[model samples]
Target: MKNNSAMTKIPKGYTTITPWIISRNTARLIDFMKKTFDGEEIARLYNEDGSVGHAEIRIGDAVVMMFDAKKEWPDTPAFLRLYVEDGDAAFRRALQEGATTMTEMTDMFFG
Candidate 1:
C-alpha cells in the first residue's frame, strides 16, 4: 500500500488495531508517551473530576488510546515498546528521562 493512499475504512494517520491503555493516571501516561516518542495529542476528553476520560495520541502514524482507571475499570498491565532509529541513544535518553530499565540492550539471536 502506498504511504499516501487514502484509507476508506480507518481514519487517516491511524491504524486498524490501536492499543488502549487503562492506567491509574492517564495524564502521566500521556505525558510520558508524548515526551518519549514525540507523540502528538490529537484528542482528549476529561471527566467531571478532572481526570482523563479518554485521549488519543498519534505516534509515528499510529494512535494509542488511554483512559483513567475507574472504580469499576481497574488498571491493566500494558506493554508498549517504542522503536527508534538509534536504539543505543534512545535507551540512554530514556534512562535520563526517568524510564526504569527492565531489560538491558543485547544482541538478539534473531538478528
Candidate 2:
C-alpha cells in the first residue's frame, strides 16, 4: 500500500490562508464582499441584540468568514489588501460603498 500522505500532487481547487476577519460592521462587510467580488452569503449568526455574531461569504473562489469583535477580542479586525483585476475600479467601488480612503489608489513600482 502507498502512503497517500507523502504524495506531492497539489490538491485541485484548494486555497491557502483564508482569513477570518473580525469587525463591528460584519453585515456591511458582507454587502461589500458581495458587491465587490460577487460573493454569496453562506452562513450567518446573529445575537439577540441584532448584531452579527458570525458570517461567511464566498467571494471569487475564496471563502471569507467574519464575526463581530467583542470587547474581549480587542485585537480582532479585518485588514486586507486585495489584488484585483482592476485596482481603479475596485477602489472606486469601495469608496462608493462608504470606505474612507486611507490612501488614494495609485500605481507603484512594486505593485
Candidate 3:
C-alpha cells in the first residue's frame, strides 16, 4: 500500500526493457551508431566533465541508452539482436561503419 506516482517520466518511443551501453567515449559511440544504424539522438544528459552521463538514441523502432564508463560502474559488453528490414543491407552498413564481420549474413530456420 505505497503510493509512488511521482517518478521520472519515460520518454516517448521507449519500452519497458531498454539496452544501455557503457562506453569509454560516448560521443564517438553515438556517432558510430548514427552512421551504422541510422540512429537518431533522442535525449542526452551530460556530466560536469563534458562526458555523456546518459544518452538515448533511436534506431528504427529500437531505442537504446548509453553513457560513459565510470569507476564505480565499469564497462560491460553486451550482445544485441536487432531485427532489421534488410539483413544484408544492415550488415553491409555495419561493416561500412567499421564493424568487424563475425559471420556473413545468412538465413536461419527457427522452427
lDDT of 1 at 85: 77
**How many pairs collide in each candidate, listed in order?**
0, 0, 0
TM-score of 2: 0.73
* Ranking of all predicted structures according to TM-score, beginning with the best and ending with the worst: 1, 3, 2
Residues 1-111 of candidate 1: C-alpha lDDT, one tens digit per residue: 577444567876778689999888888777777777777898889999998999999888788999888878755899877667777876776677678988889877753
- Tens digits of per-residue lDDT, candidate 2, 1-111, equal 887663455334325556798886798889988887667898899998888888988776777778877766667545776667887888788778888877777888989
Q: Where does model 2 exceed 4 Å of error?
A: 1-14, 71-75
Q: What TM-score do all the candidates reach, one by one?
A: 0.79, 0.73, 0.78
Candidate 1 clashing pairs, residues 3+ apart or interchain: none
Best by TM-score: 1
Model 1 RMSD vs true structure: 4.4
| Global Cα lDDT for candidate 3 | 0.82
Clashing pairs in model 3, backbone N/Cα/C closer than 3 A: none
What tens-digit string does per-residue lDDT give for candidate 3 at 1-111?
Answer: 775453346556776678999888888888888977788998889999898999999988889899998867766886788877777887887888778888777778941
lDDT of 2: 0.77
